[model samples]
Target: MTSLTLALDAMGGDHGPLVTVPAALQALKSNPSLKIILIGNQADIDPLISHADSTVLNRIERIHTTEIVTMGDRPVHALRTRKNSSMRLALEQVRDGKAAACISAGNTGALMAMSKVLLKTLPGIDRPALVSCLPTVSGKPVYLLDLGANVACDSETLFQFAVMGSVLCEAINKNPTPKVALLNVGIEEIKGNDQVQQAGQILQHTEQLNYIGFVEGDEIYTGNVDVIVCDGFVGNITLKTSEGIAKLLVHQLKRGLNSGFFVRFLSKLISPRIQAVLSKMNPDHYNGASLIGLRGIVVKSHGNADEAAYLQAINLAATEAKRRLPEMINDRLESILLDINS
Candidate 1:
């Protein structure tokens, strides 16, 4: 593989440079052809990488910026005012072709806004959607999109999201015909709101997509479908709620395992299997969400991600960059649009 550079918002997360710097270095170590541009306050970043060897230092670059977009910052404020912020600059790197992709663990709203402005949406893409993968019963990834990017979406926008999601799923999972579905209250035809029902109608007629019917929340992890499309409001709630449930399950299991002596002995017998299952279900393993439909690549990491989780985000960025995901989606959308217009 050729060298691919990723720009990182080093000061955008809760731990900022403390977490990002180590993850960057570790990414470089794992992928020899990877280069990183750390965008943040130089003072904080320098000390973290100061003890690194020449080989490591040679592949890293820094663009110093003291400005940061906090978690509390509004999207409009960040886009209009914080031009020099780390998140903005990191996105700028992708826009200018200085980086193959940009990754941030910053304010979600601000990051989404900045990325849209700097990267811009591709032709025929009305809006960029946020997409992330979840573990499934079949052991294949189930891609979910529009996770809090646009709170309200029209039928056409939702259809666009389904196309984008399908393309992304195919690219990442190598499934030629990824099954797509709309999240709804029920699998029946007349269950969803007009927007969802209409989008489903559009998708059904689009021969370019493998449009399946409605899927309820219970089917998200069933892996029966590869892509589940929804408006941002519903997608965000579903994602957060799933994350909470996963955490609760893990915590309860660990607590039970540590409880009485007899239980502890029983736990030892089944601990390895349970731990293996838990490891696969860990949220940190799936910490990055791609902001799709943009002209360039951008990944949003969890705000409180640690080095391990942040590294997973970096890996995601690298995969998308290598795949040239944006160009792929652009091409697919163009083909689909031409077919519709014809």
Candidate 2:
């Protein structure tokens, strides 16, 4: 099997090389066939590599650049001004076919903007969607799309998201005909606005789409649907709210367990089970969000992600690369368009 190569934006996130270098090392250790190209200032990256094992260090390569894209940098400004920055350079590797995928913990807006411009959108896709895996009650993940990529969308865009999301679920989850749904106020047909309702009509008529009508916010984690499509404004708010609740639940559990001797003893008795539950719900495990519908693969890690979270993001990119995700999306998209035209 050919080894997979991923480009990393070493100087893009909150901690920059401090978090990314360690994460890259961990990912390399986990997958012996994996090669990583770290793009950033060599002055900062070399010292971090010096501490790694020689065996691991041999598989790593570096592309140096002094410029960095700040977290506050505007997407347009970064595109025009910071072309040589780590994030842009890493993405360029993907466009040039030097890397199968690119992973970055940088400005979300800037990353999407640069990727769309460089990698370009796939045929039949109007815009790329920010997609991520969310844990469900059935021990499988449900794919959610448009997580703050485009704030507003038309009915056609929503239909395209459903197609892209369905392909993603099939690729990642190995489901042949994944169940797709539209996120709305309620499960009824008349719950959403004109755009959503119109999108629903299109999905219902599209051939081979396993669309199951509307899904409410409460049903997201029920494992009832394989893909959930929504506008970016709604999707972003939903994703952030879910993250907040997961953190709160974990914090409250820890606090309640440490209160008094009786509780502490009970916690020790059930700590393993509690830990298992918390681990499944941890946002760190689901840190990578794919910018779907682009010609090349790009996984976006949370800006504040630590070593473990960042490693998960790298793993996500590698998995997608090995699966040939772009090809799968293109095939499925062509089928969807053909159905529409027929």
Candidate 3:
């Protein structure tokens, strides 16, 4: 059995326990060996568990909390005022080693705030990272770091993100020595502004990673880069823009197909391919973001997430628990520092 039990925030997100509870049940079906400690009112959670299949619901246990962190509440206040809120209590479990990781879709700001205070960053890592996977052209995906949790990041933070992200690719995605790249406006080392240029130069010289040269913004989906590093400001903007573009393309494609009978015929001909493409585009497939470099695994889901989104987050938490993600990254970083000193 996996030694790590995942702490689930049963009262987070726009839908609260109603959305998260079903996702937890779905996760139990898919991942039998995984154990879950649900953080919410025992009455609320117990009813949902009873509603699930007898065999599967047996895997989950309620931790019993009564308060919740709403999406609009101040994160700091939620932690202090609602000490028993599902979000805060779940993380506290992870911090106390009662759980291996914590998963939430609650007040995003609160989750970020509470995680930093509870989990703390790993040694030598400047700041923790919020990483997500974006689709690449090669049918594979690229891991993008610092998507939105923190706005400002330095070279040292980016470096640690690289180390942690590389480990994520290896452990979660099962890629050994994943290829990493620093995101920049241009491919040339001399072309980007101060931060990009400096990170590129530093990454180019980094012996600890299989660091590739600069990756252009357009090349992110080429499947050419396994890991893309950048500051949170840039990364968040890029993530939103990419999502916007995806939506725009889908809308335009639909409009163009419905324009006329002839075009509609072509669309029907390509309908099978189109359906396949749309299926691949569902955001639920990559719904979880790792709050990497923290002491415990903390998976972040979309605030307005549906059951599928929470299901993805639960599966991600499951995977991280199985991998014991932090220990692996810490061991790798320690080895690198030791090698550098020697």
Best-fitting candidate, measured by TM-score? 1
Q: What TM-score does candidate 3 get on C-alpha atoms?
A: 0.93
Give stretches of model 2 more than 4 Å off. Answer: 51-55, 251-261, 268-276
Question: Which lDDT values do the candidates have, in the order given?
Answer: 0.93, 0.93, 0.84
State every prediction's TM-score relative to the real structure: 0.96, 0.94, 0.93
How much is the lDDT of residue 234 in candidate 1? 98
Give the Å shift of residue 51 in candidate 1: 2.5
Segments of candidate 1 deviating more than 4 angstroms: 254-259, 268-273
Instruction: Tell me how far the alpha carbon of residue 312 in candidate 2 is from the true structure, in angstroms, after superposition.
Output: 1.3
C-alpha RMSD (angstroms) for model 2: 1.8
Encode model 3's per-residue lDDT on 1-342: one tens digit a residue.
544478999988788788888888877777767678889988777777776777777778788878888777886787678777899899998999888889998777788888988889888776788999877779888999989777887776777788888989999889887999888878776776676676666666668789987888898889988999888999999988877888899899888898899999888998899978976786666798889988889999887889988888988887888888999999999987776667
Query: After best superposition, candidate 2 residue 314: deviation in angstroms?
Result: 1.0
Write model 2 residue lDDT over 189-232, tens digit each, in one string: 98989999999999999978999999999878988888999999
**C-alpha lDDT of residue 269 in model 1:** 95
